[model samples]
Target chain A: MKAIVHVQLKPGVLDPQGQAIAGALASLGYDEVTGARQGKVIELELSGTDHALARERVEAMCGQLLANMVIEQFSVEILD
Target chain B: MRVAVIVFPGSNCDRDVAEAIAQVTGKPPIMVWHRETTFFDVDLVILPGGFAYGDYLRPGAMAARSSVMRHVLDHAKAGGLVLGICNGFQVLTEIGLLPGALLPNAGMKFICKPVKLKVTRTSTPFTGSFTKGQYLDIPVAHHDGNYFAQKDELSRLEDNEQVVFRYENNPNGSINDIAGLSNVSGNVLGMMPHPERAMVHGKTRGDGYKLFNTLMETIR
Candidate 1:
């Protein structure tokens, strides 16, 4: 099984990379951009057979290493 | 004071921190690697500034999970004094040792310059050397040094007096202009400025000696 974790800074947290990207886009003549926030995505391959167990493990990984709970929120999805 | 400076794989400021500690405390600090399990006998643990793990994925994210950080977390939990400077500050936040995250600079450039920091609180060991509201010049060098936290968390930090230092000119667009903060117990301190770099009398543009001096006095 494969699990994908999407981690992002919580609301109100500054996203410098996203802001930079937004600026770059604006410079390229793409206006109407209200805001941008950057985040990370991690994909992990697991040997587990059960999908539920895989999800539990991925969530644990997020809490332990994948995401910083203080400022980041993560969601895990299982892929076959 | 016996100090332990944790050296990550990509850390560039370990020697600087050790030199500063030696200059202020008259004792060279133990240099511990990121993979080490034992922290040695030390009163203070410092996560020095640098591009740890080349700032891969996120600043200080990879280094935070290294073996040495487990010991750091344990030490901090046991009420040991831990100081994180610049990249070190990012690592602390990455490891959940401190609240908030350091994002990229608002201008999207790697900033390397000296800025004035106002000491908002003097109760912690980190800022015991400075008077409240006094400003000190410190150098900062990082691509990601803009600190961010939720509004409620910011309020809580203010209410608990955990907000230690504020940038006088708000260089990086950090929330509330916060430059440094202390943990609830006041044992863990994380700041974006490089106090270690400012420790020398001639090199530093400001009175950098006070940071180490005050911390040493408080710990002693």
Candidate 2:
């Protein structure tokens, strides 16, 4: 089984990299881009056939280490 | 003072902090590797600055889960003093020893310079030497030093006077200009400034020296 986690800064949190990227895009003549937010995507491979158990485990991983609950939130997707 | 400086793989400031502690305490600190499960007999445990684990996932994320942190957590639980500086501050936040998260600098820059800070409260274990509202000029070098906490938590920190230091110039856009924080019990401290880097008298303001000197006095 494969698990994918998407971690993103919570709403109202400032993302300087995303802001810089938006600025660079505007400088490159992309006027419609109002803003951008940056985040991380982590992929994991687990030796489990049960999707439910894999998701539960991956969410635990996100809570424990992958996503910082104070600043970021995460969503886990399981692929079999 | 019996001190232990935990050394993670990429920790570059462990020696500097150890040296500073030795100068103030009249004895060298024990350098504990990250893999050590026990902290042994020590009055203080220090997490110094550096890109621990190459900052692979997040700053301090990997190092916070290392073997030694369990012991550090236990030490803090038992009312032992723990000081986290720079990336060490990041580790404390990661391990939930302290509240809030240190976001990247608002300018998205790796800021390295001498900045001024104001002492918020002097009753904590870390800021006893400074007078109330005293200003300090210390060197802060880090990319992620902007502190963030939710509204209620921020108010809680303020109400309890858990905030020890606030930036004078708001260099990194930290909310409420918070530069250092103490836990509720005031036994643990996490700050972004490199107090160990400002120990010289003539060349630098040496305000950082006062922090160590005062800590020794308080512990004694």
Candidate 3:
């Protein structure tokens, strides 16, 4: 089984990296890009065959360590 | 009082803090490496400033999960005094020992300078010697020092007097101008300022020296 986690800064949280990226894009003549919020995607390989259990484990991982719950939100996707 | 300073792989301020503590307490603290799982018997545990784990993942994030932090958490739970400064403060938030998250500076730049801070209420294990509302100039050097928390938590910290220090001029855009915080039990404290870096021998006033004095006095 495999799992993927996407972690992003929560809405209303200021993202300096995203803002800087957006600025760079503007300087590079990509004026149409209004903003860009950077996030992380983590792919995990697990031995579990159960889809539900794998999803649960990944979500738990986000809550426990992968994501800073106070400032970021995370989503989990399971791949079989 | 017995003090222990935790040293993570990238911690650069461990000796500075240990020396500051020693100057005040008249004895050097024990240095515990990141791999240590036990804090041994100590009255206080300090997490000093530095780029722990090279600030990877997040400032203090990896260090917060190290074997040493597990022991630090246990110490705090047992009502031991835990002080985290600068990057150490970031680790405290990451470890969930302190509330809120420290984001990038609003201007998105690394700021290093002395800033004025008003002692909020004092009378805690960290600020027992300072007068309430006293203005202390402390040096802060970090990239991500902006403190943020939900509305309710911010107010709760205020209502409970857990806010130990507030910036006199809001240097990093931290919410509510919060510069330092203490756990509800008043045993754990995390702040962005580098109090240890400001200590100087004898002439009696550089700004950070007073903090170490107070910490040692409180411990005594």
Runs in model 1 lying further than 4 Å from the true structure: A26-37, B201-206
List of clashing residue pairs for candidate 2: none
Q: Considering TM-score, which of the candidate structures 2 and 3 is the better prediction for this target? A: 2
Predicted structure 2: lDDT: 0.92
- Number of the candidate with higher DockQ, 1 or 2: 2
Q: Give the Cα-based TM-score of candidate 3 against the true structure.
A: 0.95
- Taking the tens digit of each residue's C-alpha lDDT, what string does model 3 give over B28-105? 999999899654899898899999989987898899889888889888999999999999899999999999999989
Ranked candidates (TM-score, high to low): 2, 3, 1
Q: Is candidate 2 or candidate 3 better by lDDT?
A: 2
What is the Cα-based lDDT of residue A68 in candidate 3? 94
Q: How high is each candidate's interface RMSD, in Å?
A: 1.9, 0.6, 1.0
Candidate 3: residue B143 lDDT (0-100): 90
Model 3 steric clash total: 0
Q: Which candidate ranks first by TM-score, i.e. highest?
A: 2
Clashes of each: 0, 0, 0
| DockQ values, each candidate | 0.60, 0.90, 0.73
Off by over 4 Å in 2: B203-205
